[model samples]
Target: MNATDPLLTVEDLNVRFPTRQGVIEAVRGTSFSVGRERVGIVGESGSGKSMTGRAILRLVRPPGEVSARRIDFMGEDLLSLSEREMRRIRGHRISMVMQDPKFSLNPVIRVGEQISEAYRLHTRASRRAARQKTLEMLEAVQIRDPERVYQTFPHEVSGGMGQRIMIAMMLIPDPDLLIADEPTSALDVTVQMRVLAILDKLVQERGMGLIFISHDLNLVSSFCDRVIIMYGGRIVETCRAAELDKAEHPYTRGLLAALPRLDQPQARLDVLERDPAWLKEQSVVAHV
Candidate 1:
């Protein structure tokens, strides 16, 4: 692929589930692109932020259908690839860091071993080499003692440490794209900033593209180069992070106005006023 091309380009993506109620559309006609830069997808819960990420990776399970006009990654069509071909693309080319490491991590395995195994799986390195690389990655994520953490089980580490370990595992393969789904939602403010710093440094140094999904608008606006706002299963607006405050869409404005601010105190936080029309409106294409 040309260096100027986007690392991933998704067009008219949709995810649907066959439920007892009816066919529920989790994501509706969302279109976006990721270059070697950070792109934030923000919305309230069930607004399709997470579904969009899962669809890009083809992780949506059976009975839950995913269809797109094109899901081009590095000039290849992801939607057209077979299951075997897609497996090679998953961790080797693209990786996802799920929300809540407690559920994502293996309870029976040592944290260090898991990370080492990930590296070994992709590189087919010797145990000694994988171990060395794993330790280096742990330290790179700012773990205090890689030796101790490596020997300990997943339950032994704090939430922040677990998150770092997850990041280390996902990044070990040096994938072209990283999809982080609320990777810091469970951490405190101090720890959250630290994890964000680690991610920021690694992405810049490695020249990898990032898709950060979260419900925190302020966090997205501050950290990402560009922001995509979703509402009712569709992208309502897309803008440069610096220009988020100038977004004209009512859904976007409602979301912004609803946030609590220390500088501008009010009697109570504003409730986001929802419009039925937002569900029927066309999704705004992202500017990569």
Candidate 2:
């Protein structure tokens, strides 16, 4: 594939659930493409950034239904793939690093065992090989004393370390695409930077595509190559990260205006005003 070609394309994707109260559309007609570059999805809580990621992976269980005009990944139709085929693609070709390591990690198993199991399941590696790979992955994520961390339980590690461990586990299978849903949200400033740096290095080195879902507009603007702004389950704007400050959409402008600036301290931050009409706007393809 050419460098300009997209690694994944999602068109008119929708995720809905039939609750007793009514139908809830968590994601509505969202569309975007991800190439071998860092793409950030930013929105406030309930904006459907995480739901979009999960829908692409077909991880939304029953009671929740995912429908898409097209969801193509590496020339294959993800929406059309069987569960068994998707199982082969997941982790091996694509992986997801979910928010909150506390709940994502298995309490019964050691950290190393969990990571090793992921590697072993996706590949033909033996137990010893998987263990070695797991240690290497830990070290790759800049975890010092990989040997000690290898035997520790999830609860034994700090939040930052646990998040790093999750990253390592997701990347161990050498996936082509990684969807990180608020991967660094739980960490402090220092740890967040380190974890992001690790991901940046790994993505660049391995030539993998990334979908970084977060609520922080400033972080996404600084770290990602492109940014997709969603509101009320729809994409309100898409723009190059460097040009995010100049976004033309009212919703995007509102979000940018709401961000607190260190240089210009204000007594009160401007609250984002939402317009119901913005939800019906056509999705913007990636742009300047």
Model 2 collision count: 0
- RMSD for each model, in Å, please? 1.9, 1.7
User: Using Cα atoms with residue i matched to residue i, what is each candidate's TM-score against the true structure?
Assistant: 0.95, 0.95
Write the residue-wise lDDT of candidate 2 on 229-281 in tens digits. Answer: 99888898899999887787767777887788778765343554655455565
The alpha-carbon deviation from the true structure for residue 36 of candidate 1, after best TM-score superposition, in angstroms, is: 0.4
lDDT of 1 by residue, 111-204 (tens): 9999999998889999999999999999999999899999999889899998999999999999999999999997899999999999999999
Among all candidates shown, the one with the greatest lDDT: 2
What is the lDDT for 214 in model 2? 98
Residue 225, candidate 2: Cα error in Å is 0.2
- Model 1 residue runs over 4 Å out of place are 1-3, 266-288
